[model samples]
Target chain A: MQGTVSVLTQIKEDAVATPVDRLVAATAPDMARVNELILSRAQSHVDMVPELARYLIDSGGKRLRPMLTVASAMLFGKGTGNAINFAAAVEFMHNATLLHDDVVDESDMRRGKPAARMIWGNKASILVGDFLLGQAFMMMVETGDIVSLGVLSSASAVMAEGEVLQLAKTGDVSTSPADYSEVIRAKTAVLFEAACQVGAISGGADTAGRQALSQYGLELGIAFQLVDDVLDYGGQAGTLGKNTGDDLREGKMTLPVILALAEGTAEERETITTALGDPDATADQVSAVVAIMNRYRALSRTLDQARVHARAAQRALEALPASDMQTLLADVVEYSVSRAY
Target chain B: MQGTVSVLTQIKEDAVATPVDRLVAATAPDMARVNELILSRAQSHVDMVPELARYLIDSGGKRLRPMLTVASAMLFGKGTGNAINFAAAVEFMHNATLLHDDVVDESDMRRGKPAARMIWGNKASILVGDFLLGQAFMMMVETGDIVSLGVLSSASAVMAEGEVLQLAKTGDVSTSPADYSEVIRAKTAVLFEAACQVGAISGGADTAGRQALSQYGLELGIAFQLVDDVLDYGGQAGTLGKNTGDDLREGKMTLPVILALAEGTAEERETITTALGDPDATADQVSAVVAIMNRYRALSRTLDQARVHARAAQRALEALPASDMQTLLADVVEYSVSRAY
Candidate 1:
């Protein structure tokens, strides 16, 4: 793991560009180990295990959640041995949810490629998801920190509950912004919160430091997901690696849709109701919904909400001593919301 | 937990009928608490969670795994206030696997009722299964015994790999007997083994005592699953709560089918192949497959193998001191095999 970290650090020294890139470079020394552990733990004697796991794990995602864990650990400048395990565990949990989510959503592609479930059947996807989750818990248990284990395990249960709640609300135009907050909190933010909190614990952070990082992660995750929800309607399909308006087509009651429904005219509401959850909805239909969102300023309002979260995430860092890592974490939050622009 | 135990014991003194009943009665003093914990921990704020989870948890399986944990703990006459949690954790793991297994296998019914996936759909089934698993780990973490947590967590990973390996082998005639052994040892026995081992540890048993109970549970679980495979072709559909020969229809390479294929003539092999994994195979086709199995004494041989495992389970008990719980556990192994008779 240490070797993996140093090699990545060498690369980073040559190329420290974006805020996230800078964060990655800053934590490269720890993240290299986390990356190596993630790959090693994903292996199994069963051939399909690695085959399906690598299809998703190797697919290029930002590895942002694990990056938060590693960064949060390093923020305290204390070298506890458990941070790598926690970071890997967080990645496994994220990937596992993705695997099962694809199956649940009947999604054909993820990360600009066919989903693992698309290549392997749903059975393999579900089983491999279970395998990843099991591995996640195994990693946590190895940490031998019962408090941290409880945090991760509890986050896992909340994530599932959040998913189920979102599933139940699918296609329901009456979903409120409050309900949407609960959904994102459960499904997305809890994991981010857990990743940071556990990393803080591993880093030998005091109680105030742990709480601060937890708040930062929670607010950042909410902002991240909010922007993602907006991107589905406003961004280019290629940029998101999915067609624009996928959330609308999938009946996902994200904040943009909820805001539009609450504020739109009856005619606009009828337009959304006609297209929402319609798998066969055409590009013209998606355009119609976006136009309604534009008329009501719902898209901008959603972005406004994301900026609010991003700022809250930045404010969370005020609990820590001023440091370059803290400034970078705050900058990353700004960068996250800036994507909507 | 102690209060719940005493209440069940008060009732058990009047009822000790069947072998499992005797085992349950002997362990009822502790198992009552495990049962309460199972129900309470399975609950969730997400309405769909408790609803789907209880649908399976309440479906009236014997709760054999938790009972084993309780019984193993009792065998040493020690209570560290952890067995109840471990027992509940074991049951959660068992039910979680069943929920996911039903989805993977596309099974329609379980425990003589509609499978959870059948009623809740695969999405809910997959998510709820994850929720239960998360809760299982949470329960273990509450015990604060990191060693036992590692034991259960590792076993969880192995069980998932086992399931995937079995799924990979489905419909493939080339699956070796050694491969089959690996599958059951992982998917089925490892949890039983972990349950007993953790219980012994929590019960203050020494390393030797823990190993004894682990071996006992392992062999017992192997015998139990072997009998189940045999019953899939031979037992009444009503008794098994599914169709006879479901394994053959699903192309599962159970012991009888593997043995028959290894020993059958080309013509017989052709007949078996026609029906294997044929979802629409008629009773006559199943009968033909059974006739081939009978001619080769495959079913009898499988039963003989189960008896060997059962005896081995009993022998494992000799490592511990003589006690009524030990005697009941030994008898329970015999009873598990007697179901096939």
Candidate 2:
């Protein structure tokens, strides 16, 4: 009882420091190595390969996925050093996907700056993406961990499939919530699942611990993506480094749009559809749609769904042995969801 | 003395049958399995994946890279069945490159049909290419052949770098023959080298046999690309199933362009430069450029360079144990260069 109370008190005190900050601090030395591996691996004799890769790699996104890998490995208190390679590979895979995604989505901005594709053109984006993926595999192979390589490679294929499906579903007003679930799972959660699983494997975890970490990562990823989708409509512009309503403009059938479509009146649905995929959709038009969404309590319901997944993520961590890292990981999941508020 | 005479006589007797025909017949059984594996691995729940993949796979480009893998493996007569997976993976990597190439080059025709990017947009081409590449690594990982995976993954990165280099050099009249060599080696030769090397490793080859096959494939690939570049200007339209002058229009600084730029008169240089990257350059303009190339013997010189590579390929194969497959592979090298004439 005293230990439990002490842990609770410590967590409450540490809440002032964001979970990500705490995780970053705890995993700082390991992450420095991962970051170094990532930058060095991204390098090539071809100047554009490094230049375009750096444009994206340096343009800030929270290195959250790789940090999860590092933290998961640290959770077991085993230091095999393979986790650094896995973490770097995970980041490479993520950046590769981003480079290609900007091309596929014809996105103009990423991480608050002009997309790499816009600067280097789509051809460079595609080839550099391939380079990074190749580098990712090379890093994994160098570690001699074929199992982790399989996890990461399989996750890569799933991510591409997800992108293709998302492309097919774009501007598709009839896209169901089920289809959306499949898209987000393949595109987002599987990498997280693999990242954590490989980290656990590198950390010398048992089968049960591996499974628990995998489940936790998957649930957290779902919650993370769900929050991202909601934030696209509701997030402050500076907060995300991307314009709000970009998803709606891209005709992405995200949860908010899907829910709003399901619950809106005929005229309201007409307004939503009109603004759904129109790139020239005005701020007034977006606000109008948001008003309709609010009227239907769509955004709140979506966040509610995110909370369910977040809770599931925390519940997954409960299966692991109690430790400060485990608790911090759970807190990270909570932080991921709370970003929406 | 009698044995040498008989072998020479047998080679003469076999000359009537084309080397590719003989090689195809010899490796038919192995290649069939490789083809089956390729088709199966290319399948996806997403309809577009299979549809687009098959469209390119079925379009006849001679499946040469995978065939090289199969033949190299057969040369050792040790059947681990791992060659089939490696062969399929080589094909996937090749196809993925083609898919992305069409998008990057903005090509209209591939193997006499419209490019995949034309039917499916650039986004599909990019995503499907990533999918195929993912499938390729997945196949390699499944074999647990980390050495071969390392080879292919490294080759994959080199290929991408070559492409980025080529993109940077496009339309640059200052591109040297050395630069051209670097481009072809990175883009084309490295994959050939890897395909054969991995096949040798899978077939239980020693270090020497592996090196011999790697050298053979590299030289053959260089010859193959040289002939390909020459054919873009000199071959009959239907023979190659692609229009001549594509490289010129696409601003590709192939050997002919570089040589013509080096040897042409000032006016000739002007004419070549003007038609170099002009997609809408008329047939007469292309004829004018070809006329300049003829005056400088640029096309013949390129083929001469190709023959040099072909001879090198045959020389490399001589280090291996003499077999019908070896003789047939050498003949294929001859056949590849002979296409330019």
Candidate 3:
């Protein structure tokens, strides 16, 4: 009983220490180069390209994706400078999607500020997103590694497909868990998979190590998104960097909504459908939906789902030769799910 | 007098022959492969990809850029098979821009059909445009020519910069002719230049031949856009596949508008500005603007500028060896400007 309590206390202590912090500290040297490359590449002879790009790039997001790329590269202890390029490319791709997503979703705010679209208008947002995408490909090509280029490019296409699929399923109550899985995989996990895989490639990881990192990224990304979906209904707005229930207001068919709808009673379904996609849904209605979700443990179930993937992510890391970087990556996966708890 | 009349008649007959038509006929065999590649590459496991893609790709915009790529490749007759891929990538880039352009312009029609956004909504249009861009890069990477990839990627960045610049300058009457030149060059000419350059690279053109084709494409693109600017004010909807005076209504600062603004009286400038970017500007207002433009010979002046570029395009080909394709290309430049006459 004493051992169990001590282990639980240790886990709680570790949870407070974010995996991203460790990842950042470990990869800080390369990440500085990545930041420089990102800023330099985002620039253009045309002033607006850099201005709108900097708005999103400098928004102070954790830069988690690029950190993953840099950390994955560090795992092999290979000093190929290509990781800096891949990290920049990954960051650019993520920012491009955010800019475009804000426009498509008519999102007024991102990262707790007026979106690029809100400041520059939708046309500028769309075009600047294209600029970042162009820059990303340019950086990848500069590495002169066609194989990594192929991986990133293919991920780019799949990410678009995933977004379109989600757009297609928006507001439809019949969206299956399987469909939700596909959406999250495409929209989130694929980039993570590509980011780490490209980093591994740049780091001179052999086929096995590359595949292992790819799996780790994929599972971690899935957990990350599942937790995001849960947080939308249950997390504080400050914690989320946006409104608490943006997914609900956007009519996004996230895992929490999917699972809740599957298990809710008819009256509870009515409560959710009434509020789902209602950009004007009141706080009272949100509270009511949360009540139902709690009664059915839907939020907990979503977190449970995230935990499964988080564990899988850690398992994938076991395939790599054990290192401090590997241990830190595994802990980050746990912290991803712990955000909900 | 008889000789002069005979020569004039011959020039008139040659002016009726379009360069695009000649190039199209010459490159018909290779273009079939390119068309096949375009159709195949546009497919996705996601159903919306093909539906939205085909809506714009099949709208019949002459596919002129892809034709330039194929014709440039055939200049060397090397048959490296990279031309088909380059041609498809060029076409995809063009179509992707058109999709996003329709959304940005809030255009109601394209190729005499309701815009894809009208049929599928803004969200679909934005996402599908992204898919096509992703597919374009995928095809470029598949060619395994990093040099050509760099060319297309840089062009992609410049094109987006141009569009954003245009967006920033939209509805601003003070936009300079120099600024207008930069906009058109970045927005339109860079793709044409990249398309032809990539084709030359793939076709194994000598340095002189490659530079010749690059110059030829850049000049030809400038001429093509100048003619388009003229046609926007003067051509019938049948020829334009869009309403005349769209530039004025959209507040676009095309050459005719810029020249007219430069030379017109204060009242004339006021008359143009009243209708400029006025979505409700009527046919009478359009006619009034055209009257002022004609009074100053702005339309004629615009066409003259186009002719300079067209002739320069032909001059660029003089650096290359004389071939049937070369003569046809020169004739096409003449035809490009002759449309106004």
Residue-pair clashes per candidate, as listed? 0, 0, 1
Give candidate 2's error at residue B67 in angstroms. Answer: 0.7
In the predicted model 3, the residue pairs found to clash are: B19-B332
Which pairs clash in the backbone of model 1? none
Local accuracy of candidate 2 as per-residue lDDT tens digits, A1-341:
23333544565576478888777777777888899888899888888999999889998588999988988888875433899999998999999999999888889989889999899999999999999988888989998989998999899999999999998899998999999999999999999999999999999889999999999999999989999988988742213323778998898999889999998989999999999989999888888888887888778788898999999989988988788788889989888888988
Cα error of candidate 2 at position B201, Å: 0.9
lDDT of 1 by residue, B289-312 (tens): 888888898888888989999999
After TM-score superposition, the amount by which residue B273's alpha carbon in candidate 3 deviates from its true location, in angstroms, is 1.1
Docking class of 1: high
Tens-place lDDT per residue, model 2, B1-341, is: 23333544455577576777666666667788888888898898888989999999999488888888988887885434889999999999999999999999999889889999999888999999999999999999999999999999999989999999999999999999999999999999999999999989988889999999999999999999999998999652213323878999999999988999999989999999998898998777888888888888888888889999999999999988887678878989999988877
Who is ahead in lDDT, 2 or 3?
A: 2
Top candidate on DockQ is: 1
What is the DockQ for all candidates, taken in turn? 0.83, 0.77, 0.69
True contacts kept of each: 0.84, 0.72, 0.72
Candidate 3, B30-120: lDDT as tens digits = 7888888899988987788899998788875778888888878877664247888988999999988988999999999888899999999
Off by over 4 Å in 1: A1-16, A78-80, A235-242, B1-16, B78-80, B235-242
TM per prediction = 0.95, 0.95, 0.93
